[model samples]
Target chain A: MKWFEYQMEVDQLHASDALKARLLAMQPDSQTSRDHSAPAQRGRAIRFPHWRRWAAGAAACAAVAVVGSQVLLGMGPAGAGISTMSMTAGGAASSTAAAYDAAAPEAAAYSLAENGLSARSAAGADSAVAGEKIIYTARLTLETKDYDAARAALEQALAAAGGWMENSSESPYDNRRSLSMTLRVPADSYEAFLAAAGETASVVNRSEQADDVTAQYTDVAGRIANLEGQRDRLRELQAGADTLADLLDIEAQLSDVQYQLESWQGQLDWYDDQIASCTVTVDLREVETYTPTGETFLERLGAAFAEGWQNFVLGLAAVAVALAGLWPVVLLVAAAAVAAALVLRRRRRR
Target chain B: MWRVSQEELYRIAVENYSDSVYRAAAHHCTNPIDAEDVVQDVYEKLLRRKGSFSSEEHLKAWLLRVAINRCHDLSRAASQKDVPLEETMPAPPAADHSVLDAVRALPEQYRNAIYLHYFEGYTAAEIGRLLGAPTNTVLSWLHRGRALLHTMLQEEIEDEMV
Candidate 1:
């Protein structure tokens, strides 16, 4: 035989005819055969009645309307409320919005007033400027076995530093007491106040914030001054002889300008009080029981089992409720899906 | 005069040409099951159509066209599903298998031409009609397949010589 013929023979041997025969004999799965025949019979059965279809369409429209109306309501005028809240001082004293640090106090206050305004405005909230006095607040948390001793030390420290408790709360359940107060210690006595408060508590956590409202205060004062000047001019015009209509108009304008001047003065005075007093929030945790007890392995295992059972039951209930709520939609969608699947299978067979 | 219902004609067509169609499809599909499926599908198509053909040649061409189309369809569908090629193909008949094996091992275009020309005894023109290719193209595929076979056989002979 030629070289070509010999190679052909070998290749012919390696290529198994049995494999092809076996492949030919293979049949489509029973499921596929059944699925192929399924759609030809009941595709007409699952369709909804005309009235039901109309009802479904109406329901769908109603659902869309309800959602649209809800979104509109949420965005309407009622949604607009106070955009910002300002905490102002009660007196003319400049209240520092910032904690007093040893560096250039005036420069720090200036940057704070400008930067604070920008930051608050960026946050879509109103920003207030404080006067020259910087209010520094420190919160002290203490956990002590000797509550009376801790209280006595704190009181003495506050008295020595001219700091007093503004508010105090005691929880009966745990014997845990907390005190929150604004301390109006002079600028020089701030360190002393901190040290005194530190002696009463273990000083678990402390945070101090500084706010500069000088620019805001000055702006308000300047506005009040300008409005007063305008009001004065209006009054002078009122004193001079003028037409009745002009007098009424001038009086109205003067009232408006006076109202603005009063508003500015009110804002300026509030900022002044904020600078004068330092407000601090303190939380104290009492060590009522410090003894630690070990749990047995069985006890821990039982707890884990209980937790697992509780979670499983809750999960099952939630799933059941969800399925119940969605059963109508699920059934309709599933019927459509199954019908589509059967049709596709039959098409493939052909 | 011979008379047969359209259904009988369909049955007759299936019985007579199904195996042939399967063999033709098997050459391309490399899988016996897929070949059988292609044959069945071809018969189904024949049954679906109005009973009309000018001659046996036309009928056979129609069956061949359906078989070839089905084979290609099966190949494409299998590729989309990332199915293993071996699953759809059956083992070729064990006895006298070497011929079929050698025929199938050829490239897809080459194998189809050689199978139709040699196994089915189709001229290049007839293959062109069935394959929807130009006669010259069918001839080229046959020529190239033969050349490749010759080279491969030659290599085998050298291996035996060693």
Candidate 2:
């Protein structure tokens, strides 16, 4: 009755000895096809081949996923680049690898370079955008020497542009704090606000986009009008109902119409809000010095030397902190060594 | 896999670790023939694998993991196939087979944990690593599996007495 006896029953179960001989005798050259056994004809062999195929298919899918992600990060611009590049940017900047914000001339120049156009010629594409109902979005990456001054100036500029902070996050990088924030500014002042942000600090990168939503806005507005008409008709019908059942049925239909009307109204309101204001996301980095937009050979050399010096100082500090944390272990090892030496001295004297 | 040659693979798998792999598979696969087939597949994978194992224990663990995965696949396939209730109904166990039937009839999740813990002497921590679950979760699985096994064995003994 002992449950441990179950182990003996399990012990009696094992792979047949012939299976080992067969496995050892398998030719490596012949294993690639894995069709050694007619898998369909076997009593027990059929189950595992299904999983073998599944595992192989899974591995192939993993490889595809890896390559697909690399393509995304390599060629694709930042999220809104589809609309920006498609309409305002001549749709020829697909080869541009820089996907950051476009506040700096270098970013526009970067795209301009990829477009193989003359400097500042990309501006023609931006100026060609004439859509009345468009959602404007601007992303800026700035480097600042003084966070408090930069922040105060940012606040003053936001107030001037009639903008409000929507979402903001601040985190420290190597003892220096960096702030990322999303702001909503009136579309009229989006260009002025970005220019003001550039003056706050050294602009590292910038990108601008105009998403034309006129057709979508008109379609939603039309739907809202239809829903409102239906709701109004339903309300008028409720008053003219002839029987209790008709009255109740009309009431249900009226409520359903009211729900659809509100839903459509919400969509129309969202479109209106998007057209009225621009979403400006800014990344403000606090740096000891600005990175030289190295258009010259001397500037590039100076930046590389400065970076090397900074890295060497940081490495020394890291080693000092690491040794400081190992004091207890060092003490223990020292104590053991002293004790062992005393024992050896006593044995040698004896 | 090439680290161990053809003769070495046969010796290590058939003599050293095939029983372990077979036993791990058997905890889930009630059919002995299917369990043996899983063993052969596990060794076949080892032979074809290009990666070198770090140690003998690594080789054994690899075999066990492959065996368990194959058993999972086989069990899933088995579950989806239709079987009449009459065929699935457990026959009265022979006086000696009450233990095996009781063990075999355990719910699938508990079967591997119970067999590895009770028969193979794997602690909850070792079972946790083998099954890729947290140690605390493996402890609970062992606890529940043990309780289920005790109840089934008790019922079988009572029936035998009658």
Candidate number achieving the greatest TM-score relative to the actual structure: 2
Candidate 1 per-residue lDDT over residues B36-91, each given as its tens digit: 55555665567567757766667777787777666656555555556564533333
Count clashing residue pairs per candidate: 46, 5
In model 1, which regions exceed 4 Å deviation? A1-98, A103-133, A163-165, A174-188, A288-350, B1-162
TM-score, B chain alone, candidates in order: 0.77, 0.78
TM-score of each candidate structure, all chains considered together: 0.33, 0.41
DockQ of predicted candidate 1: 0.03
Candidate 2 lDDT, tens digit per residue, A1-350?
66546767777877677865665566555553442332222223212225678899999999888655543442232223323433433331243233233534455555445544444443334332233355667777787879879988988999999999999999986656899999999977877888898799877666676554545666676777777888788888888889999999988888888888788889878978987888999989886655555555576445544544444466677887787889898889999999999999999656
Question: Best lDDT goes to which candidate?
Answer: 2
Enumerate the candidates' DockQ scores in order: 0.03, 0.14
- Regions of model 2 farther than 4 Å from truth: A1-131, A330-350, B1-162
**Residue A327 of model 2: what lDDT?**
82
How high is the CA lDDT of each candidate model? Answer: 0.57, 0.67
**TM value for model 1:** 0.33
Considering only chain A, what is the TM-score of each predicted structure?
A: 0.45, 0.58
Per-model C-alpha RMSD: 25.6, 27.2
